[model samples]
Target: MRTAICSGSFDPITLGHLDVIRRAAACFDKVWVCVSPNAEKKNQLFTPEQKLRLVQAAVADLPNVEAELFPGLLADYAVDHGANVIVRGVRNATDFDVEYQMAIINRGIHPQLETMLLPASAEYQHFSSSMVREMIRYHQPLEKYLPASIIPLVRDMTERKGE
Candidate 1:
């Protein structure tokens, strides 16, 4: 079975991420939407558990894809899960650059695995997790960027934008 891992902090999965997952699912036999924790990052709007749950709910419609929390190196996780591909969403040149470097590092660890970059559709090409967090802080509408099911779950983060 051909399997792929879509690794990300997914602090809050966005519609763009969902779009990538959808595309990945169509190509791979199985896709894991992993909410990988990052130790270098200290401030996160959602915990790994919360992110995993949100991802699970948001992607429930996809039968071949599953949401999970992975706490170690992505190559190791891929090996453990028998995944042969790492699917990533490249929204812009910046993302491509970062993911490209990561792709090199991950392949160094597991030479058999490959990284597949799926460029985000035009509508989602301009957004990022940090940008979404900023939008939440400024009380901006999230309907255009995030999965519809995610808004209610993140009310505590976005609803109290001011005062």
Candidate 2:
């Protein structure tokens, strides 16, 4: 099977992230939507488990996609899961610059793995987890950025966190 791992901090899964996963699912036999911890990011809005649940809810309609929480190196996770590709969503040059470096590093770590960068669809290009978090903090409407299935859950989580 051609398996691909689509991973990110996913503090809360945004529409852009879901778009990439859905596209990846059409190309790969299976796609793992992994919720991982980003060492570079601080003050996460949701726990890894909460992120996983949000991811799961967002992608429930995709039969070939599975949501998981992996706190280890993505390269190692890909190797263990028999995934030969790591899929990333790139919205602009900045995203490409970072993903490009990560892809090269990931290649060095797992020689067999390839990185597939999918440009975000125009409608969701401006949507991101950080942007969503900011909106949530201000109690703004999230219907434009998050999946319908997970908006309520995201609201509940943010409310519980007293955001």
Query: Which candidate ranks first by TM-score, i.e. highest?
Result: 2
lDDT of 2 by residue, 1-163 (tens): 9999999999788888888999999999999887898878987899888999999999999999998888899999999889989999999999999999999999999899899999999998877788888988999988898899998998898888888
What digit string (tens of lDDT, one per residue) describes model 1 on residues 52-72? 988998899999999889888
Candidate 2: which stretches are off by over 4 Å?
A: none
Residue 34, candidate 2: Cα error in Å is 1.3
Candidate 2: clashing pairs of residues: none
Range of the 10 consecutive residues with the lowest summed lDDT in candidate 1:
154-163
Candidate with maximal lDDT: 2
Error of 1 at 120 (Å): 1.1
Please list the residue runs of candidate 1 whose C-alpha ends up more than 4 Å from where it truly belongs after superposition. Answer: 156-163
RMSD of each: 2.0, 0.9
